[model samples]
Target: MKSIRIDRNRRLRDDPGTGHNRWHPDIEPLIEVAPGEEVLLETRDAADGQVKPHMTFADLAKNDKKVGHPLTGPVFVKGAEPGDILEVEFVDMTPQPYGWTVIRPGVGFLREVFDAEFLAHWHVDGKFARSPQIPGVRIPEGIFMGTAGVAPSHEQMRSWNARETELVSRGGLALLPDPQDAIPASQPIASEGLRTMPPRENGGNADIKQLTRGSKLQLPVSVSGALFSTGDAHYAQGDSECCITAIEMGATAVVRFNLLKGEAVRRKTRFPRFSHPGYFAAPEWAAPHNFVATTGFPIREDGTQECEDLTLAARNAVLEMIALLGERGFSREQAYVICSLAVDLRISNVVDLPNVCVSALLPEAIFER
Candidate 1:
């Protein structure tokens, strides 16, 4: 039951051997902890070491894009081998006093239309966050990771690359080796810099807010020792995460790791699953406030919704939200933050043919009169 803590002083590339941001099988381990030991991890925000409280959009534009989801740790667990279940239990999370939400050009679900970059800053206080600039908007704090998981294996890498490449050849979205326009060859995981931008089977970037304090995420080990790393902490976020960025904040996650040894308990988990000590059924973070819902249909009767894309559908929902908030005199940036923190997306009908509608729900309580 050794308790190990890693902060800004220690990271993957911050050390002599381990890599940074992107995931790979080869990054050296920083600590070797026994099974069922607790680990305290400190992480920088998604802006990698830049984008502080005083930074503007110009400062954000200057951030290095080399590291996709800048995080902490690759602690190698003792006696843990491949195919074992690495139970990452959430003991608690300590977030920084400030947080941010961004809308970058050509990113997120509505890239084409919302092309201009925008930024909104918040005063985070563990329980709630609100921006003085935005006015009358209160975001209830719900801390959970935007990215967390074990590094990928060689076989998993192949599978990932093959699938993404196949999709790209057919004009699908590209996401494998992060879209860094110029990645250095000497950078660790450079040649094989598997982006942590999208979620994968290895559990990278699993942005489910249901992974709050009372839950444990069971990730199947791919490589030896279950080289685990985590970052991209968000104070709160909606389901669709249409804006790309959530309430991005730097937080410390105190996690207890356990190795489910032998062939018995390991058989219970195939994909990543959760174990909650709380109630029977927990929705992704409690939203007790009544919400105004809007339905978005991603089709226009003659197949003009562009390949029936889910991205288009999600964006349509967000657009409807923007319109509603605009009618109430909220700026688009304010509306975007409202969407990230206060809105939730639900699929109304995906099998209805020629039209899939995603409903975006805006919690009425966030608006202060």
Candidate 2:
């Protein structure tokens, strides 16, 4: 299999030729591969190696957020073109021995309530992720790439920028284009390149944990050669990465690409789609043989209700789960981290108008008896 390797000690910016941190059609491809060829990519952690295992949460403020997702490649699939479908089959994933999860202030699902920074350093094996910072819990390994995508066409980039600019004007949250710490550090590409945080039609940072080994992700191509790139490996993560992170780590991903000519155009697919062959996680953890579930409605603590707000419902469910964990002797910070690493958030009801119900399920099997 062909591969692109990088030094774990160095950042992707230090060797930009190996990878890039932004999404633009003109970034150029590092290597070319035909359909059905398996390629191995060595990826940096989501923070681009900025948050090391040795560092505590106190050091998080020094890291550059702009250099967040350092993706491995824009591998030129030989015949891929716009409107084609790039099917990436994940064959295997190997995580580094150590991993981390962090809760930073001013971010995440409960950012308003969780303003304090917390961090957990984990010892990851093939089967589980165990952290000393949050004791008594083990997160089952459901290794997957948190970010993966094809570069957007120039038209898509311009259109996306215009729309996001409008959103920012309307007091919405959007990470606009900034060149300060861009990897390629080129001229107009650096200044105009789209940020990798939002998953677009080209599928950037869609942090779905179910894209594990044996899963296939189909990305709608928008540029010549597909310019496919990936990074932000996760050892394990819950359905809702409520804390803004999972067991984040550097990992080597083995994937095989197959081009479906004009498939995206034929189906008018504009977003990424994925399918897993068997269980995405070990069966026991996937279905949770023994689970503790906390249900929440759109009702807030002040007795105010959100009309069919699924986001608020999810937030309430997670908060309730955290409180339950606190009752079991865990600190609020530790409970939040636990929720991020292992709590699965499920929508129990949405058809009930004016009130949505969400459930946060914590697998009891994760805790040692």
Question: Clashes in each model (backbone N, CA, C under 3 Å)?
Answer: 0, 0
| lDDT, candidate 1, 1-369, per-residue tens | 443344554433454233257778877777778877787777667766566778888886666666667757787888777878888888888888888888888887767767766788889754678887688887777788778888788878878888888998999886667536312235545667677777787787878877888688888887888888888888888877777888888888888888876532448555687767772454424554478888777764366755455556777788889989999998887787678776889888878765777889887766667
Q: Model 2, which residues run further than 4 Å from truth? A: none
- The deviation in Å at residue 279 for candidate 1 is 6.5
Best by lDDT: 2
- State the C-alpha lDDT per candidate: 0.74, 0.89
In candidate 1, stretches whose alpha carbon ends up further than 4 angstroms from where it belongs are 1-19, 175-188, 262-270, 275-285, 301-312, 351-356
**Candidate 2, which ten residues in sequence have the lowest lDDT sum?**
280-289
What lDDT does candidate 1 reach at residue 104?
Answer: 85
1-369 per-residue lDDT for model 2 (tens digits): 799999988888888888998999999898899999999999999988887778987788788869978999989999998889999999999998888988878989999999877889999756888988978888888889999999998999999999999999999999999998997899899999998988898888888888888989999988889999999999888888999999999999999999899999999997899998786355666678689999988888899977989988999999999999999999999999989888999999899978889999998988965
* Clash pairs detected, candidate 1: none
Give candidate 1's error at residue 319 in angstroms.
Answer: 1.5
Q: Candidate 1: worst 10 consecutive residues by lDDT?
A: 10-19
Report how far off residue 182 is in candidate 1 (Å).
11
